[model samples]
Target: ATSVRRGLRSTLRLGNRLAEEWWRQGIAWRAMRRGEVVVFDRHFFADYHAYDIAGTDLPLSRRLHGFLLAHAYPKPDLVIYLDAPPEVLLARKGEGTIEALARRRQDYLSLAAVTTSFEVVDATRTLDEVTSEVIALIRAFEQRHGAMATTS
Candidate 1:
């Protein structure tokens, strides 16, 4: 019965994630179809890998579901990971511990390494510097795709 309960929980979670992904993707698709550039604050797979589903403490069911959902989701054209030292992240967030933040940062780096279009911008820099770097990346992507800037 415990295994059955785990299965049910996993199934429900998978369904919910898929539904959310479908809705979010619809928004992105519509925007892109209108020749607009869409930037997502955080991709679902990256968040899952860092926070919820990557740890060994999680059940096998959840890990499996996460794997499925990750594969099902479409890969982004560009993934900009704003990276900073763990101490800086902890100070800024006032939430997670330094060690935990460090681990999560490493996870993000690993994810970036695997992705085709990934950039790690130094978030420890000034806001203008970071913004400029991100803008440059987007502009490069737009140029490569022959896309004219429709909106800022």
Candidate 2:
């Protein structure tokens, strides 16, 4: 068990490093620098281990990696968490067991709780409704930040 855990941790570290590098050179970073409203389908925060698995019981390296990944990147101006029941998520994705989906949902909710700029939208709603709500959130953010002006 210890060996398995060690292997997982090593893999996670490498994956995190690669992901961070990619993010630094990714479209999101470029758009942000250009003063555009970036709509990420899934952001870094969404990928971090949640509070449940992020306890001190884990190795120091694992905990440190989680901490750095959670804080390293520039935070999104608005985090619209489109939340739905685990069953709904399972149905939509056609992958993952209900148990796994539920765990992921809890992780997302935990992350949302600690985020300063977070909004939960009912993702089970009709596509139009969800899109409208997301648009409204974006508009509100733009209003607060002034219209996003792209750099030429």
Candidate 3:
């Protein structure tokens, strides 16, 4: 238990350091500043709680680290979570077990539940269908917020 706690703390500290550096780079922020749609392949939220470190009492340090990392960069205006079944993910990736995939799916669902600006899309559908859904969502967002300026 002690070792698991230490490992979690170490991982979080490293993640926090890397996120701070990325925030300083301003790559995402610059694009958003110019009204460009920033598509993040994998955001901090996914990675922050990727591991399930077993412990009855989560340390305050861990919570603080998560809070700081989350606040390191401005939250995205919209987060589109593409979700697929565990079996589908396993068939495609040929890596993680169904249990692991299911756990991740639950984590993502829980995160989406708490987040104010988030949408979940079924990725088990055809690629074209998924793309169309995402495009439709983006269009709706644009209609609501007005079109973003194309040029910086």
Candidate 4:
């Protein structure tokens, strides 16, 4: 989910409705059809839609918690939660901006409820370490479920 923060922020603006439909519905549907690996990054939870858009203010956080408990999204086959101490992340980010921290914290907290397909890890380590950890997790999952191989 190493995506552009600016683009994600824009997803909240009015101009992004079309982009959302294109990316979420159109793109995802096509990917599934093609037997492709559709890697959804963040906030595809149903309640993330604004109250006006969704027709009621259902409290996104609580809704997400309940949704996770019911084995939603198939737990995505695997969920790699990259976590680090706030201070470590702050040091790595340098600017120590509250806005940046807030965005990251929100993402992390939301993922905490997920468990079956999730592996929470310390991200204060090296990039190679993170990659190795993720690979091990995926391999273990594939062993259990049989690999869902894709070609392009």
- When 2 and 3 are scored with lDDT, the better candidate is 2
Could you tell which candidate, 3 or 4, scores higher by lDDT?
3
lDDT of each residue in 1-152, candidate 1, tens digit only: 99898788888877787788778878888788798888989877677765444556666656765665556666677789999998998788799898988887889898875577888899999999999999999999888867733322
Per-candidate TM equals: 0.82, 0.74, 0.73, 0.53
Tens-place lDDT digits, model 4, residues 2-65: 4565545544543354346345645665675676556566434422322322324444433443
lDDT of every predicted structure (CA atoms): 0.78, 0.71, 0.69, 0.55
Q: After superposition, how far is residue 10 of candidate 1 from its true place, in Å?
A: 2.8
- Model 2: ten consecutive residues of lowest lDDT: 44-53
- Give lDDT: candidate 4, residue 145: 67
Q: Which scores better on TM-score, 1 or 3?
A: 1
lDDT of 4: 0.55
**lDDT (10s digit) by residue, model 3, range 3-101:** 998878788876776666477437766876777777777666555543322223556565655565566544455678899999999999999899999
lDDT of 1: 0.78
Clashes of each: 0, 0, 0, 0
Candidate 3 has an lDDT of: 0.69
| Runs with alpha carbons beyond 4 Å of true place in candidate 4 | 1-36, 41-43, 46-75, 95-107, 147-152
How many clashing pairs does model 4 include? Answer: 0
* Local lDDT at 23 for model 4: 55
